[model samples]
Target: MLPEAEKLQFLKKTELFSELPETELKSICQIANEVAYPADTTLFEEGDEGDSLYLMVDGEVSIIKAGTEVLFFNEKGYCLGEIALIDNKPRSATVKTVKSTQFLRITRHDFYNAMAREPRIGSGMFRVLNDKIRRDLEIQMSAIRKEVAQEESMRLAAEVQQSLLPNQEISHPYVSSAGYCQPANSVGGDYYDYLSLPDNSIAIFLGDVMGHGYHSAMVAAMTKSCLQTQIPFDASVPEVMKAITRVIEGSRTFIYMTCCYLIIHPDNRFEFANAGHPQMLLYRGNNSEPLELESTFMPVGFARFCESEQYYSTEVEWHSGDLLVLYSDGITEACNPDAEMYGLERFKALISEKRHLSPMKIKTEILSDLRVYQQDESTTDDITLVVAKFL
Candidate 1:
């Protein structure tokens, strides 16, 4: 048996009963009997009817379920057998002492006695436990809501981004064009657009922003709108790029765009300009070799001082069985599970083997090769490609 003064000291230190008055605490302590058990003794077995609670005064106890220890409790104020005290439920887990232990035991009868005398204290304890249960439920519900919102946002952004791209197939009197874009994630920053010039010349453009997600998607949208407003059929590629650079420079957010633009005329002549974009490939069926049209200047938004005529143009004869491929860096830089890059060599092999295939087939084959090589690895970059076949 514990002395009256020591029992009161224990109750005063416990947060749950600290608010109780000294007289009520003394009455509660009178019903709590001190017990001792040898080491490795089972205090309560699983599935046993629970009718009492235990407060450890010394030594340690382990709560075990299915022969596996789940929780360990030590220290003077640790309480156990809460299922009995809270709801009169069967013991959900077994408890055993790690060493010789002393505990203050309180039975269901004693608990009812205290509650009967101080109903307000009983209500306060129940309220605190109820609030904790509600908080856990609320946290789980909030996590589910956040997940659903992110998925919906991605779906909507992807639809908007797709609407900004050119149609699947475009046919003009002089040339036929087709392109494909597959974002590694739900949204992307790569964009491609084609416009028929008033002078019967066809203008084509492909650009990629620096990053992915909503911020990059928004930048791509703004870039397309800005280009449409600034460039006309008469405007040279250099002039159009300069206008785009000016717009991006004025914004506080840092963003850069790599672009390749080309204008094709009726006489099979081509004028091309590049800004830090991947080299455009031109495959001539007559000769087994492929021509690489390389980049000439830094990407857009890099230059503060704009040059009046910093563009280059090249003329090429368009005949039957000619293929031109323009693509984003995502294709060549793709990595497999082994960390090997799908580099220029693989690209050249695919093209060399499928040179005779149609524009759509070539596009399909390239993407198929990328997926096979990646082998279930998630794509880390946005994939975009454009193919123009001269017929």
Candidate 2:
């Protein structure tokens, strides 16, 4: 047994019992037994039922599992056996002495007696344990809240992107148009819009931004506003594209846009200008092969000169039952479970198969095929499709 003076010194070193009065410390020392064990002693094995708590006075103890030491407690005030004592369960891990060690063992009976004698001491112990538990719970709850906030932000961005899309049915007597956009994520960089001009011409735009996420979503919004300012229906496709290029090039921000603009006349003829967008697919009829109209210039905003020669124009006379499909790279780049791309061949086959279907039906079938092929893999790119058919 340690002398009262030595016991008081030891108690003072332990923060857990440091607040107790000298007399209380002496009382606790009377019931506690000092024990020494040699190196390599099995202090307690996993699955053993423990009835005593131990405080280290000297040397080290290793808490181990499956031959691996999980923790090492070498400090004078380090305590163990709390889990078994509080839960009344077997030890979950083994403890062994790394060298000759001195320790104080407090039996369950002695601990309860101390608690029963001073309810305030017991309350202090309970408060410490409860505070630690509450702190851990708060940390876990904070992580959950952060995750929820991110999802909410993404969902709101998606709704805003959807709001920017053009209405499905154009009210013009001579022209009929429909557009669809599917973002691989909650928000995407792909966008499409249609506007009716005062002179009875229709202005249509399809663009794909360089990246995805919040920045891309913001750029998409800015691009929509720029298009509104630059392209009135009276403007030819080339003029409208030039105006858009000017807006993007003038911005101080680092962003680029790949777009195609088309102006449709009431007489059933249309003119289009391309700016590094994917080829536009023209399916002449059910049995005919699709014609790909490739872009001639670099994507918009990359060059200051904005050479007009690089821009190209095309005119096509629409006939009843002819289908015009405009799409972003996302559709052709979509990968299946086997890592195969849904390339132009599959696109042609599907369009040929569904050519008799209405414009809406063709869009639905293509999207459905894309989903099934990907097997619900997360989308890596934005997808937009615009369909114009002569009825």
Candidate 3:
């Protein structure tokens, strides 16, 4: 058994029990078991029926989904496989120890028993689970953005993809935008565009459709046509998103596009919606940490996230010198020679360090860093990034 004070302290850190009243926490500490294991120990694997969840007191864990290691957590206070205990579902990913690790563990039986004693525990857990479901869905969607081998027949597809690129420069007095796409294949599935609206506001979007070849390119082209058509009719974030959704769903193909589309006005108001894309970062001047706009819904063509086929946008103010960063999964999920991902956290830290640079200069630094980080490994997917800076 671990020290009572240490157990209580780490248990308080787990999101599962973090918000519970102290009395309840102490009650949980009674049922919690302290455990330790060496590196490479299997906590659980994908497809296993989950019986327990763990809170890391201190240690490292790798999360593997479908044979690929997707994420790792060394951050103390992070919860592990939490929904498994709550829902009793088969594990969606495999989790294993990467270092000699310690955990505060609560099995399903103990969890239910504790909840039976205090109904409030279940209530708080379910509240956290609601957020967990959304977050897990986004993580799953991002993993699906992997690259596959393209056929030699995709030469014309390459030409079509090249046609999909919008002007790489955004020229406006109050705002500046720059985008870059470095395809790993002859035909890249990434696309981005911006249009100056009749009202003088600007609509900007970046999209990544998975897979390669002609069909993917055609679907992207169709999506572009839909976007242009919709803006003239209804440029509201929801309506334009719906139009894009219709084009993709109507295609009846096995592809989906993750997108972050935003409308920024001269008055400093910007509205955007993320459809299962990676989180967009908003850096206010020179703040060390960014305000993250996380994924708001399922990917565009996976239209089930829509309530009555309508979408919603998040609004935020863009102050002078604020930088908005949008990117494809390729950039953040790139693996190094060791098969370790460069990772989203590392990417964010890089941006936070370079938030003061002009958009194009920041773009240059991102490519520079990626090259240095990737070293001997050739990336399988396209590298795409967009940065908008308000002056």
Best by lDDT: 3
Return the TM-score for each candidate structure. Answer: 0.66, 0.62, 0.59
Residue-level lDDT tens digits of model 3 in 176-265:
988987677776778888888998898898888876445656777887888878898899998888888877877755678898899999
TM-score for model 1? Answer: 0.66
lDDT of each: 0.79, 0.77, 0.82
Comparison by lDDT, 2 against 3, better one: 3
Expressed as tens digits, the lDDT of each residue in 1-391 for candidate 1 is 7788998999666644667888888887888789999999999998898888787888898767656565566878666675466777788778899899999888877877787898755654664456535643554565456567878988999999999898657587767876988777788889888877778888888888888778778878888887788666344676777776776666678788888888878787788888899998888875656788888878876775455336556566777678888999999999999999999878977886887887788888998999899998888999899988887
Clashes of each: 0, 0, 0
Model 3 clash number: 0
Better of 1 and 2 by lDDT: 1
**Clash total of candidate 2:** 0
Which ranges of candidate 2 are over 4 A from the true structure? 1-138, 250-253, 304-312
Instruction: Show the colliding residue pairs in model 1.
Output: none
Write down the worst ten-residue block by lDDT for model 3: 144-153
